[model samples]
Target: MIILKCQYLFNKILSKFFNIYTKLSFSQTGEDLIIQFIIGSLQLKKVTYLDVGTNHPFNMNNTFLMYLNGMNGVCVEPNPKLFNQIKRNRRRDKCLNVGVGINNEKTSTYYMMENSLLSTFSEEEANRMEKNGEAKILKSIPMELININDLIKFNFTTCPDVISLDAEGVDVEILNEFDFNTYRPKIFCIETISYSTNLTGVKSEEIINLMSKNGYKIFADTYVNTIFIEENLFN
Candidate 1:
């Protein structure tokens, strides 16, 4: 997530003299590291999480660092190819090869894009990606769907400590379905920037407002994503 974290650690002598202070965050931004800092400061020995639209296990993944640190949780990915890879590498996690949907649908049409990261269950989103020249739709498949509430209910006894969600364009829809009253996650790292090749990408204000209305405040905004912490956590 952190680009050139050791940006200052370059030159020949410096490289040999000092170890590169590498970036451990796998998030597109330094979201995982930020979340880790906050949660680690809480002094909890362990934490739990739920990663939605987990495209890759360790690449541009918001929850991978936590996994490496011994935190356990579930990963939901619709693309079977990606799911298999995550399941293989994240052996300790409960990897579910299914799409998250607003309603409890038996199955939904999932579009696999040329760039797997652009894949989505929303036909409109898939079409928009192709129309905008962001990516090409490689193929489509009927993937099983799961409700967010049901997901948390079945996977966790209480609620997970963190929910790192990046469901392409349906992220807010998923959040809207999350039973916040029943379960309150302490932190959330969500992809809040719209995808764009040019400089046309815009922040999702709706998401910011929604989180605020739910008594969460922005912990950090890295342009690509935003990290939120429940206000009560400070109390």
Candidate 2:
């Protein structure tokens, strides 16, 4: 814990002093640094983000770096355990223990995978991964499942500046349901591939086309996740 604090402090000092020239990524593949670079170029002093299916508070989290920079947003996690961890680490953010879904259901079956990060609400995905020996289902529980637009409308006065979504198999569903016309998030970092253990996951053409149609261009593709920037903002 002490080491983490020291590292956090060291990282903050470097970022504040040297700007984005110095960065420490807590994302799966340095996505946060890329996000920070883009946000740095913006005319804004602070930005808001919504992390859907946000598994961790800091470790391997997409928005933790921004939190350390004194920015706050909302984090949605269906797993109670993970939600507790996020609430503890990110006291500044509004952390909710709920799942993001496309339907009007109040709750969904939350599949807790053996590898917690791969957990999902999709039975098909859970079964597929378990069959492939990638990860087994540890447990299943009913959790609150809110619609994509409802999430934003309830949480933010306007669209968040960034939305980091990784709802396992439901990433595209949530993204598709988002009200792009009403709310325009500046950036979106979404898990854009089917999960796999043997490196055969297929890329999500649906997500790519959806974002493109919404006027957001692909800024970077980290395989695990794809980062998109608003066309107007990118220009």
Candidate 3:
């Protein structure tokens, strides 16, 4: 019976792969490139993704591709307003109104701006803006903090296939707190907003070095985002 079950699952996976390969072959050039890279690099029919700071769940997310390919995962957003937006957009996946950082605690007084895109938890960046005389602040709800390990203890049966981080100014801090040796996700997609804000932004080289220390290699570096894959996984 165990062998029969394994054979059934193997046949199902082979069928799915053939279908996906056919669809991919006929897809548009740009879409085909992304699908091929993700499917080929990760070697999975369905992926588990974690989108940190998934504000508003815009249409441009790479996670959307996973969803289209019959994958499911969690979306974490700290801001209440933005979290609601994400919840509305990603009704199929688990959406959490929490922040990913070094610890699990309730934080208060997160800064909100009229332009929601500028909202962040970094008071230092807010203060720098005040110095530059362009400061705009509004009171907002606090986000519950949870580390990556905490998530593993909760819902994840296995490490996520991909983890995309877009936590505004705190991307570096979140990456630093990740124990890559333990939860080595297959791919990491991080936003690089260094040019947009006056925050103490991390340089591209700094990001490369941090990922390298954790046994990851840079796969792609677009102007707005950088992609990293586990070195051992790709080999």
Top of the candidates by lDDT = 2
RMSD values for the candidates in order, in angstroms, are 4.6, 2.0, 8.5
Q: Summarize candidate 1's per-residue lDDT along 1-235 as a digit string, tens digits.
A: 1232233224323546785444455788788889889987887666999999899988888988788777999999998988999999889999999988886677889999999988988899999989978899999999889999899999988799999888888988988887778888899999999988775789999999998988899989999889999899888
Query: Quick one: ranking by TM-score, best first?
Result: 2, 1, 3
Across residues 176-228, which tens digit of lDDT does each residue of candidate 2 receive? 78888998889899889887777789999999999999899999999989999
User: Which ranges in model 2 have alpha carbons more than 4 Å from their true place?
Assistant: 12-22
Can you write out model 3's per-residue Cα lDDT over 2-107, one digit (the tens) per residue?
3533554565577787653323121212332453386665677567888776666644455654554467789987778777877876677899987775544446
lDDT of 1 at 84: 93
As for lDDT, the candidate ahead, 2 or 3, is: 2
The residue pairs that clash in candidate 1, if any, are none
Alpha-carbon lDDT of model 1 = 0.86
- Superposed model 1: Cα runs more than 4 Å off: 1-22
Candidate 3 has its poorest 10 consecutive residues by lDDT at: 20-29
Name the better of 2 and 3 by TM-score: 2
